[model samples]
Target: MSPTCELADLVLPSTHWTERDYLADEVCSEWVFGQQKAVEPLYERKSDVWFWRTFGHRLSPEWWPWESDEELFDWQLEQTHAGVTWDELKEKWIHHVPMMPSRDFEENGFGTPTGRAELYSVIELVSGSKPFPEATEPKESVYATPDVAKAYPLTGVTGRRYPIYYHSAFRGIPHLREIVPEPQVVFHTSLAEELGIERDEWVWIESPTGRITMRARPSDGIDPRVCVIPHGWWQACPALGLPGYPDGSSNANTLTSDRAYNDEFLTPGLRSTLCRIVKKKEGE
Candidate 1:
């Protein structure tokens, strides 16, 4: 269970990887991995396939004809790759597909309205945007919003990953929590000195949108004007005497804004957000 699950009114027990059979593939790789189940589902828990198939059957029996995960896997394999079977996958555990020859763009041209790897897109022009690519400053940054930048001078990058935990996961695990006890605002030594913050000391990282408190972790590798704060810090490790950090307390998204985004994809400006660090006083 996770922080999201903790807040859920109705929780359904799902099978762990050890209790489920599945297929996994590495990105951009020709290899496919068959994940064999090591153990059966304990208690009232069931595999996601079971849960979905059960609900799907009640909704529409015609579409959810597969009675077992193996049947579904067979159909998936047939659709994705020919000459591959479930039994062979279970026995081998891994299969390497032969890579296809690269398409000759020079001979056949690219896949577009105006092929040949168009630098100026006809589709974009038709959509009333620049035909060619144009790089611009983010709408909520030090460069674009100078007036707001005065209060928030540092560039705050959110969701810095830790080896021990995935985004907002495994924090409740004692061993992992011991490895990374608390979330820290990682910045340059110069910035730490300027703000009179020491290593492992609590500090407030305030942006124009919002603010969050985290332990200060100064490093020489990062830029003085930039700070990296990790996300997913809600779960508590009772063994470490660490309480769960409330949503607005340490979650990086609390300091981010959804008001402005990229012109092309509408990705919220998380990395380019402006912020400032201040050392936390006693009892605060």
Candidate 2:
């Protein structure tokens, strides 16, 4: 069980990807792939649409009339007005939108108040932002706060994602865990050498908020003044005999603070925070 699931009062068993029919979209890609259901959902497990439809029927049957996923998918395709059908998608399993190498703005004009491409936005100005974009330094970065940087010299980069898993998912899978056994603090080889940290050795990455321990992994590609840590890591793989790192242990979020955030969006300054790396003592 995951840390989140452990905290929850009740957990519902949902149908896995292989047990559902769905469409997948890749970022910035023109191709849409159709996935067919491999097997019926196991006991007590239901697809997302099933849950929604069940609730909808109880609440308002008139609003949610589609009986099954096939009906819902058919209605969705009909709204596209492209004459694409569920049977066609299921047969081919892929559809590609032909991209024309021409700007739509030339034919239909830009979608703005002035109907033109704008370097300075009037909408942003009305919404209490500067007309032109400004590049400001991160609130907790080494360059922004020199005094804080003196104590925490290295730049900390968090939320490094790997291809084996999406964010913190698939960690409980034995095969995936075999590839990435535990969390790691990735830094430059030169930085690790200077700190007297050995490869695969435990090290503490400390920031103003908190500190977390991760295995040292020195890489030549990383900047000497920067260290990267992964996030979303609260799952355990029992088959591999690996213990799950609890919250605030190897979790990179422990080192970040919500105090410093983007002025416009209020996004926390976790990416470029200042931190120091130190070698952990044996059995400490």
Candidate 3:
């Protein structure tokens, strides 16, 4: 039997030879046994296996046969030998996978665990996590602590915009520089006035963890309780090997704490934290 079939037999012992299993087997085998010189073999194989396993059942009946595992393996080997990288192969596989079935929701009942639309989930009750269907403030809101509030008085939100030219990456592109051109730190107008900071003036946004400087854009649209910092700024200082961008300063990932992330879901709480901003002093 093929390596795919062998793996399938090992993992899914009870299931019959379905087309889903066959396709999954082939994809996994290729990822595992494909060329390693141009790319990592095991990494490629594991990723491919996951992709096929996740979406393989969505394939239509007409495309079910999968043309045999041997043929699939041979084709992958040929592609690998031709210098096609694993990333490229994975992309090809994703592009070629059959599209999901299109049908009105009324015809097909909801696919929830209870077989009905769930307003609240029993998942939390069973899993011993938060017992709610929607987001709620953590049992211990970090902002509630007096020390945390004093240290980081403003709410710091990250990932508030697109990757290209959002935070500090704008310095890398000339066109982006000509257009947006500068790092923008958004704050509530009331907060800016309270801090005695003017719009378009330099402000130092500091949290208990770290600090960075950006031009303030005080606006009424933002919540007064929160301060917004768009992600993807690369610190630009001549001394730091990046010149033209004196303030190429960011990658919110660096300042964010893994411990502050959600407990049950493990989602990063980048948007739900407090921070404080002040006017940057001259000569420093």
Best by TM-score: 1
Over the stretch 1-284, how does candidate 2's per-residue lDDT look in tens digits?
A: 67778899988898998898886647344655678889988898888877887789779989888878778777766654435677788888887655446588888889998889999998988888888999988877777788998999988888688899998788889998899898888999998888798899988999988899989999999888898988888788889889788665988888888968987678998666789898887787
The local distance difference test score of each candidate is 0.84, 0.83, 0.57
TM-score of candidate 1 versus the correct structure, residues matched by position:
0.89
Candidate 2: which stretches are off by over 4 Å? 25-30, 97-117
Residues 1-284 of candidate 3 have per-residue lDDT tens digits of 22235456344322222212122224533333232234333322433433453346356535433444444544554544434433554445422333345465577767766766676676776788755667666422443566777767666778677545544344555554444455678989998888788878877777666777778999999888777887655533333333343333544554566546666888766654566888878875
Candidate 2 has its poorest 10 consecutive residues by lDDT at 23-32
- For model 3, give the 10-residue run with minimal summed lDDT: 16-25
Ranking by TM-score: 1, 2, 3
Put the candidates in lDDT order, highest first: 1, 2, 3
After the best TM-score superposition of candidate 2, give how far the Cα of residue 26 lies from its true spot, in angstroms. 4.3
Consecutive 10-residue window with the lowest summed lDDT within model 1: 23-32
